[model samples]
Target: MDKISRLRGFRDIWKDELEKLRKIEEVARKYLNLLGFDELKVPILEKTELFVRSIGETTDIVQKEMFTFHDPSGDSVTLRPEATAGVVRAYIEASLFATQRITKLFTIGSMFRHERPQKGRFREFNQIDVEVFGSKGPLIDAELLWLISLILDELKVKNFEIEVNTVGCWECRKKFKEVFLSYIEKKLDHLCEDCKTRARRNPLRIFDCKKDECLFLTKDSPLLFENLCEECKIHFNKFLNYLIKFEVKVKHNERLVRGLDYYTKTVFEVKSSALGAQNAFIAGGRYDGLVKEMGGPDVPGIGFAIGLERLSLIVNTGNPKENLTVFIAFVDDKAREHLFRLVKQFVKSNIRVFYDPDSKSLKSQMRYAHALNADYAIIVGEEEIKNNIVSLRNMKTGEQKSYPNDLEYLIKDISYTK
Candidate 1:
């Protein structure tokens, strides 16, 4: 018989890789808590309409990537490809807006998308998502960038760049779309099939294309920033100024329209050169109309999601070290009985211990301890039992000592030595 293997585009996380992921999550939680953001956990499965409505019907995630299907009840459901939609649904269903003037939330979990998996891209991926609702000011936008920078800095991620852009509001986009459409129409023949479809359905998305031909043709296209309305221009300028005031350095990219349809006015991405073509480890923008679109009251939102897989590729978590490791070695049946008691005591005291439950010989047990890189070995036998003392050997120094059999004394001595 053949053994079953993990599905493609998925991976088993363990050992050092898992440790690094945990460290990154820990740092994210620490900063989010300090910034007064509460954690919110949402289900991975959501109604298919939730995404089709929020992420946009013409977006790639809805058209091609979503893992959507009908369940036993015959209602369309999907494994969430992103989090904002689900978060918004929760906010409305829970009537959170009725009580709080402003709400800030952060969530850490897995998202599913059926796209071609690459170095940092996966069908099943993890993200640290943060969202702020109610305020439409540029201050929160700048502050979110600062928070992202703080997290990356704490994780020792170096040489990353923050890129910013403004897609403007719907009214500004309405005017820009006309001019953008004309420019794209002239070069539609030279663009890829996907870009051509985008040109017809959502011309702004052409700027998100990665093909050299599409990029070359759109490089000279009209700039959305230059065409921004008076209101959008003022908001964008304030956003840039706020970033400067916060001492958060950012590069303005006129063509940096993110792939999401809900984005309006401000958009940003954190890029790392080390990650190559898929360099963006963090990306998000304001979705001022999404709340109302999701059947909630008119509210504004700004948020970002950090791809842990891409982040882990660049972050150095260093060697994971155990605080202390102990091994219990016993010689005879009586000594084995004592080992069991000592093991329980050590565990209760929050110590890591290793022992053979099958009553292996003292030599065999000590060898196992050495293999496990134990810090110390506690040897017990009839002699020590009669003497009412236990033998403690420093595995590193090859030195030995005897302490009273009392669990308190042994625990204290081990801790003090450590």
Candidate 2:
């Protein structure tokens, strides 16, 4: 029979990689907490309509990438392609909008999508999502950007640029989309099929198109800044002023339309030169109308999400943690019984211990101990068991010491050594 193979675009995050991911998550959680954003968790599954309503009917996520299935009860369910929609749903369902004045939330989890996976994109990937509700101003936008800055700095990811934009409120967007699409429509035939389709349903998305010809066609297309309404212009300018005040570096990118339909203004993405053409490692923006759309009162919100897998790749430490802290090796079956009891005692005391069941030779056991990178190799032989003592060998230093069967004392010594 052929060997069973893992699925493409999805692979096991083995111990070493998981350790790196854990470190990244820990740092992210600490940073978010320090910023006064409480941790929040939203389920991976959500009603299909939640995404359709928030992400928009025209986007690829809803039309193509979503993993939608019908439940046995004849209801439509979807593996959330992103977290923001489910987050908005939670805010509305729990009535958090009315209860909390400034509900800042941070989430970390897997999101599913069906896109053809590549270097940074995958079928199942993790994201660190943040959402700030009930506040609207340039100061808040700057604060979020600064938070992102701190996260990237903590990870030591130095080569990243901040690209910012404002997709003005609904009133200004209607006019900008009209003018922007008209200029691009003249060159529509030059664009790819995806761009052509988006032109009709979501013209703003054309700016975000990755197709070679589509990118070229949108090179000189009218910018969204020129068509901003008085209110949008004021809000965007104030945001720029705040960015200057906070000393956050930002580049005006008219093309930064954060994909989601709910985004009203202040969209931004952190791009890295290390990741070639697909440079975004983190992206987010303001969604002032999402609350109202999700059946809550009108509330403005903004937040960002960092791609965990991509961040892990860029921030890998290359060191794998050892499985066992101490290995209990016995010389004979008689010694094994005593060692087994000692192993149980160590386990009960929360010590990381391992042992080979087979009565192997002393040489083989030592080899296994070295292979496992055990800190201490506790040797229990007939002689040692007779005296109610064990010989502890430090694998790295080739030092040895005899200790009584009191596992607690042994563990304390090992902890100090570590």
Candidate 3:
């Protein structure tokens, strides 16, 4: 039979890569917790209408990218293309806002989409999502950007830039859309087919097209900044002033309307040059109206999602060296049983221990320990067993010593040696 294979846009993540991501997650959790945001586990699947209402009907995500289908009972369900909608749904259904005036949530998990697979784009990918509710102050926006700066510094991701803009609220967005449509109406036939469709339905999305022709066509298109209402302009200006106080520099891109239709007021993206064309490692903005649209109370919200796959590429995710582990090798069945019992003791004391179960030759066992890059190798042989002692070899310095067979005592010895 042919070997089973993974579907397109999906692959397994092995140990070395997973270890790097795990370390990054640990650091992320620490800073997010320190910032007063609580971790939330949002489900992978949600009702279809939830997204249609929040992400918008004409957006590319809902029309083409979403992985949606009907179940046995024939209710439309979708694997989440992004996290914010599900997060908002949870915020409402669980009544999280009622308990606390402000809800700060962070989620790290898999997101699904049906986009073409490339270097960083995948059918199934992971994202670190952060959301804040009940606050619309421009200071909150600056603070979130500062949080992103901290995470990037901690991970040693040096080459990156923050691109920001404002899409305005419903009122100003409507006015801009009418103006944008007129500018592009005469030139629609020259744009990409997808942009042509978007021109008729949702013109703001034309700014997101990657085609050179489409980009040229929209080069002189109306800037949202020029059309911003007095209220939005003031809010955006105050946001920029706050960002300056935090020393978070940003490039003002008039065309930085994010892919999602829900964004309003402020939007930002973190891009890296390491990954070609698809370079955005993180993007998000304020979706002040999404809460009520998803059947929740009227509340302003803001959030961002970082793509871990792309992040792993640019960030210096070093391969961990297992320097604190020990490998135990036994010479006989009697020795195996005795050493196995001591393994539990090492674990209880928070020491890492591993053993070869086959009771292999001493020379072969030593090679296995070296492969693991162990700090010490504990050899249990008939002679050492008879003497109620064990031979310890330091893999690093090529030193050997005889210590009491008790792991509790050896734990202290190992600590002192370091």
Candidate 4:
């Protein structure tokens, strides 16, 4: 018989890695709550059309990366490759904007994309999605950027930099795309196959290509920032001023156009040099037209998502604390049964314990406890069952004591030890 294996690019987080994920989640949760953001859990599968309409048909996600399939009922459905589109759909379906002029929301979940898996990029990955709806103020962009910096600083993720730029609104983008098209047309035969297709479809996507030939040809390409319309220029300028006021260290990269089509005004990415090949750990920008474009109320929104897999890969603090883990050993059927019954109480009370229910020998159980590096161990035997007490041992100090087999009493003892 052959064993089954997990699909390529999927992930199974365990032990210390899972601890890091939970820690990062709590860190984001704390700051988001302080900033007054509400939590949301949207479905993983949505209508395929939703992403295509929002993420742009020309983008790689919709074109070659989405895990799309027809549903049982024949409706085209897709596992979400990105979350903003689904979030906006929910925002519209719930009419959240109508009830409150300004709505803030944050979500943490897995996003599926069928791209070739890299170091921290997987087919199914988790993200911390943060978005604010219903205000066009530049400070909102600054605030989102500040939130990114705060989380990274708290995580002690070093050597990360924030790169920002503006691609202007559609009107200004149209003017600049023409200038880029003319420059690339002269060297069209020399460009990569992908960039040639990009030239015919969406010329601006040329800046997003990483092929060596494309990168060299576009090195002297026209910059969109220099050609932005007055309104977009002023909006971007105000966004820059607000970042300064917030004391954020940002580098202006004129070529930093994000992959999504809905972005306008200000766009940014929080990059870490420590992450090779895939450098960005967090990125997003202002999308003033997405809500309206997706058939929702006309409102402005800005948000960013942190790739937890990528962030956890680079952050230094990922070890799990063993002091919270307790081990329970038994030497008889009666004691084993009692321990099993007490297991429910420990679970309900948020205690983590390692237990062997087969009444293994004390020496063998103690060796297993040592392997787990448990902080405390409780020996259960006929004597313990007869007395209705527990023989608790502090694994670190080799101290043993007898205590009433009461959950509250054990909790009190544990708390005191802590």
Candidate 5:
């Protein structure tokens, strides 16, 4: 029979790659906790209508990317393509707004989509999603960008830029859409099929199209920044000033209307030059009306999502070396049981211990220890077992010490040395 294989666009992450992802999560959690954002874990599956209403029916996520199906009960459900919709649903259903005046939440999990896989993009991916509700000010917006900057800097990601723009609220988009639709209508014949469809439904999404023809045609088209209403213009400018206060350098991109339809007032993306065309490792913006639209109170919100796969590609996770590793080497079969008991003690004391279960020769066991890059080697023999003592050798320095066969003393000595 042929060997079973993982599905395309799905991968098994382990060793160094898994370590890098873990490091990213660690850094994200540290800062998120410091910022007072509580962690929330939402389900991987949600009602199909949750996304259609929040992400918008015209968006690609709703129209094409979602992994949706009718469950056994015959109700349509979807594996979340992104996290914000589910988070919002939880916020409303749980009535999180009744207590806290402002709520900050973060989640880390897998999301599924059906799009064609490419570099830094996948069908099943992981994201570190952050969201803030009940605050409509630009201060939170700038602070979120600052938080993102801190995470990238700590990860040692180099030459990444923060691109910012305003897609404007629904009222502001009304006027801009008229001018945008006119320009798109004339060039619909030359645009990609996707952009052509986007023009009739969500015209602003035309700017997000990656096709050369669409990009070239929309390059000189009307910009939403120019058409921003007085209120949106003021809000955007204040957001820029707040970003400056946070010392976050930002590039104003007039053409950046992120792939989501819920974004309004402020939109931004963190892109790395190292990742080529698919450079954005982080993307988000304000969705001030999403709460009200989802049948909740009129709460304002903003947040961002970090693509762990894309981020792992660019982050430098330094060395994968973990805690001290000790190898148990025994020369006699009788000593094996004693060493096995000692090994259990070391593990209980929170030490990383390794032992050969097959009673291999001492030389073979030593070689295995060296191969594992263990920090210390504990040698046991019938004589040492009789004496109630063991020989501990520093794998690095080759210095040996005799310690009484006491778990406490052994653990203390190892802890003190390393």
Candidate 6:
């Protein structure tokens, strides 16, 4: 049989990378809790309709990137392209919106999308999604954006810009779409193939197109801000005022039409040149109509999702911790039994031990101890077992001590956190 290999776009995360992921998640959890947000977990696989309805059917995530297949029961299920839709599904089905005016919740897990994998993007990726439900005021939007800024600052990611835009409400968006479409119709041939297709379905997506030609053509197109309805204008201005008061540095970008169709009013993305021309560390906006669109109450929500893999790529933490309490070294098979008992005793007393039964020679075992950075190496031979004592060698200074069954106390004495 031929040896199997991983698919082209997928890459495995090794032990070190996994450790970094854990650290990032830990910090994110702490920050989310500090904001009074509770943790929530949703499944990876969900019914295809959830994404089709939440993320627009015309969007690339639904039209191309989703991993969808029929289940054994003949129901179509998709590996979730994003977690926001499913999180909303749970909120509706469980009636979470009925009671709480501001339910701050968050989730950290992997999201799947089928795209040409590149730096910071993958077939399998992880994100930290946070949503503040039932908050219609612009305060919630500013609060969420400011919180995201704090997280990036804490991570030491210095090179980033917050691009902000307002898509206006339903009434204003209707008129903007009319003028916007006609403005770009003359330059249809100049657009990339994908942008040309999206022009008919979603003209706003054309601005987000990465093609240099399309970018140049739409560089001076009509902005949504010019046609904001009375209510939307007030909301956008209020949100801006709050951001200023909160001291959040931001840039006014009229072209930021978030990929999701559900977003209305405010939309934004945190861009970084460090990740390349298409870099965005976090992206989110106000989805004022999504809750109701998903069969829930007429509640509005705003939130953001941070790219964990992208954040981990730039985090330069010094090497992962190196500390072990007991390193057991045995001379022969006869000493194995005694070594096993000592190992069990150490573990029972909540002491960390590192040992390999195959390692026998004192020199080889000492090398292993140094590699593991063990504080003390426990040497056991047939003679030591007969005397009910074990030789403990200090790996740091080459000092030796004999312990008569007080392994737990000795380990605690040396392994104090400085």
lDDT of 6 by residue, 1-418 (tens): 9999998667789888888888778777877888899998999999999999999998889999999999999999999999899899988998987778778989988899999988888998889999888989998899988888777677676778999999887778889989989999899888899988888888888877878999999989888888888889899999999999989999998778887889889899988878864488789998989999999989998888888888787765557765457788887778887766788877876678888768567788888888888888888887677887878888777898877755665666656742
| lDDT, candidate 3, at 187 | 96
Q: Lowest summed lDDT over 10 consecutive residues: which window, candidate 4?
A: 316-325
Question: Clashing residue pairs in candidate 5, if any?
Answer: none
- Is candidate 4 or 6 superior in lDDT? 4
Q: Quote the lDDT for 323 in model 3.
A: 45
Candidates' TM-scores?
0.96, 0.92, 0.92, 0.90, 0.92, 0.93
Clashes of each: 0, 0, 0, 0, 0, 0
- How high is the CA lDDT of each candidate model? 0.91, 0.85, 0.88, 0.87, 0.90, 0.85
Model 2, C-alpha of 308: deviation from truth (Å): 0.4
Better candidate by lDDT, 5 or 6: 5
Q: By lDDT, who's the top model here? A: 1
lDDT of 3 by residue, 228-337 (tens): 99989999999999999999989998788876778899999999999887899999999999898888899999999989989988867777755478889888777887
Clashing pairs in 1: none
Tens digits of per-residue lDDT for model 4, 360-386: 788989999999888889888899878
Over 195-310, each residue of candidate 1 has an lDDT whose tens digit, in order, gives 88888888887888888999899888898889999988988899999888889999998888877889999999999999978899999999999999999999999999999999
